[model samples]
Target: MGKVLTQDAQRFMVDCLKAVGAGKKPALQQAELLIEADKMGHHSHGMNRLELYVNDIKTGKCQPNNECKILKESEATAWVDACNVLGATSSHFCMDLAIKKAGKAGVGWVSSKGGNHNGIMGFWARKAAKEGMIGMAFTNTSPLCPPTRGKQPVLGTNPLSVVAPGAQDELFYLDMATTAVAFGKIEIQRRKGKPLHPGWAQGTDGKITVDPEEASKARILLPLGGGEMTSGYKGFGLAAVVELFCGVLAGSKYGHHVRTWSLAEGGEPANLGQCFVAVNTSCFAPGFQDRVAAIMQHWRSIEPTEPCLRVKCPGDRERRNKEEAESKGTVTYLDSQIKSSAALAKKLNVTPMQVTAE
Candidate 1:
């Protein structure tokens, strides 16, 4: 592993974005989104994706400078067209609209079309949380998850996220794809030459497999509960609901119609759909924060079944990851990641990330 200063990583991402003709503000926004993913231990959405975004913009699949516009609007709802801009840019536009509506109407709901892969859903939700409101976000991706008891995939790994602030400096955060695991986990396992866990994926035959290579090639991830025996249909249904909020509501390419981005780039515009919502907590019953904090604290107080492990609330792991990374002022990346980033920098004529240690 190589440790790079956090600021250096951010700078490299910003520089690379600028090299791809992204404006300064959009570049910085995108870089910060990726860096926050690394800080939260979600490396799949971090610097590893820089090359993909660069390729997207270079191929004209994304217009970083395009302006998003409202197609229609109501007191507390809106429909938006992202105009094929970078994911971060569109997300910020949508979430800002949601926040403004929530401020006036107590709740805001916005659906967007013609979007890109917005690194982490939690980032959008946190934007609302920071404003002392409950925030929610959802997005639809390419088809990767098959329905329960079905052989062919027709639903994406649709993800949903929710975030809320609580008293005593606590936060309630939940963000996850409806699949048992993200496809990126399979990619990591394939790169490491390790077998996948049984519940993580299925092979081409559409049966569960522990082989990483097969799973990666099959590109078929299991639903959140794994198999029919484990009630995976529940996850399948939840994924569908997420899609309803994004693609269906926003009227974008949905389900099987969504194009597969895979690991490579240079495809048509993703035309993905996304949803953002914000609700002012003050508009609800009083003491919402105290109630949330009490529940979280109670969960943490539960006796652990294992001596080596302790109970945690939903956001505990990410909060801890961010704290540790910030305390050290650095992030550790796989040697391969560092090398690839260097190659990306060379390819784009941008300054490479400076490695402090290896």
Candidate 2:
């Protein structure tokens, strides 16, 4: 493993994006999104994704310079065309609109089309949380998950996130993919030369497999509950619900219509669908923040079944990870990641990121 200053990682990401024709603003915004994921210890969505973004830009699959525009709108809802812009540009635009409308109308909902892969859903949802409102974000990606009891993949991981602020700097955060695991996790395992955990993915024969190579090639992830007896169908249903909020409502590419999960490779644009929502907490019951904080505290105070393990709130782990990263001012990456980044820097003709021995 190697460690790089968090700032250096962000700078390298920006340099690579700029090298691939992204504007200063979009590159910086996208870099911020990725860095936040690293800070929160969600490495699957952080620098691990940089090369894919660079490839998309190189292939003209993403038009970072294009502007997003509202296709239609009402007092509390808006439909937008992202115009094939980078995900950060479009997501920030739509989330900002939602926050503004929520300020006036008590709630706001925005649906968008033509977006590239956004790093993490929680990043967008947290924007509203910072404004003292409840926020939600949802997106549909390339199909990699199969329906319950079925063999062929038909739905994306279809992630969703919800975030809200509470009293005393407390926060309620939940971000999850409907699948048992995000496909990026498989990539990480493959890079580490490790096997997949049971129930994470299926082989070509539709049975669970621990071989990372086979799982990555098959690209068939199981739903959150793993299998039929475990009620995996519930997860499959949730993924479909996210699809409804995104592609179905936004009129973007829906399940089975989305491109295969891979580099851009001269293919058509992703045109992924996304949704954002914000609700002003003040418009609801009184003492909302206090109630939220109280519940989170109660959860943490519960006794654990295992003596070595402690109870935790939804976002506690991420919060602790962020604090640790901040204290060190660095993020650690696997050796494989460092090697790949060096190769990417050479390809893009950008300065390689400086790493220190750990």
Candidate 3:
């Protein structure tokens, strides 16, 4: 039988976040965002990140309850200073503020500075879509991917997300990292002693590698499609665009200017940046909602070649995972993840989730 666990992972994560530094509803909201991602099978952005956050807090990279402040604002644009706030909380606040601004002006753009790594971008965009606004968000992270012609890690696995609202809380969403695989996913694989899939990364000496530990230590990830001949160029270009917005445009670090957290060294400075925009499709054309509905309907109506596979929209898989996790109580985490959480909680003087009876 598969391992079983109890307690809503969201609540437990929230408790731990609160116990550390999150300390309020914003932190709780951020915790839920990550927990939801894990439950929905986006393991790359899930509970595995908790240890990183804990290290961030302990090392002063993330502040507890340090709400970001607006550095500037206009009818359709804004800038925020995260004040070293947790990325999940800060990004959510920024996106909500943008959505509110867009409701008044029909569009809003906001760039943020000094934020830590937020969870998945789709998490925030879906919020705006749910509120009847078209949502888009982008973020930059520590350099983990090599540029098209370069061998060293210089660009972040910058991500982009877009969401459109539909009938019955249905949503059309696209959220993707610009890399073939995020470093976090690679790290998880390394911890589990698993091999990286073919075409995911290159070693320091510019050779393809499948050993996760080796990949983590001395390799750089390829772009979304693996190589230029395989459409990785497109993903590389998109990642650069986001970097321009979050780094150059926001006046923050770009390329290899970021520092990453490691368990041994504790939290270190990561001067990251991000951008978010909300569009009121209603402003662009009448019957925009109907048009979106039609577009998605047509996409989903496409016939599947294989009977076992069904047409899937960006957010569909995640939503289905959410349903399964809700019914099953807690999400199933790898043993390493369980131990990591326990260690962090013990260090912080809080009760961690009991992963197994042992």
When superposed on Cα atoms, how far off is each prediction in RMSD? 1.5, 1.8, 2.8
In terms of lDDT, the best-performing candidate is 2
Q: Candidate 3: minimum summed lDDT over ten consecutive residues — where?
A: 1-10
Ranking by TM-score: 1, 2, 3
Better of 1 and 3 by TM-score: 1
- Choose 1 or 2, whichever is better by TM-score: 1
Residue 259, model 3: Cα distance from true site in angstroms:
1.3
Write model 1 residue lDDT over 170-207, tens digit each, in one string.
Answer: 99999899999998889889989999988889887879
Candidate 2 deviant stretches above 4 angstroms: 184-198, 209-214
Candidate 3 clashes between residue pairs 3 or more apart in a chain or in different chains: none
Best by TM-score: 1
Expressed as tens digits, the lDDT of each residue in 1-104 for candidate 2 is 99999999999999999999999999999999999999999998999999988888889999999999999999999999999988999999999999999999
Model-by-model lDDT, in order?
Answer: 0.92, 0.93, 0.79
> Could you tell me which 10 consecutive residues in candidate 2 have the lowest summed lDDT?
259-268
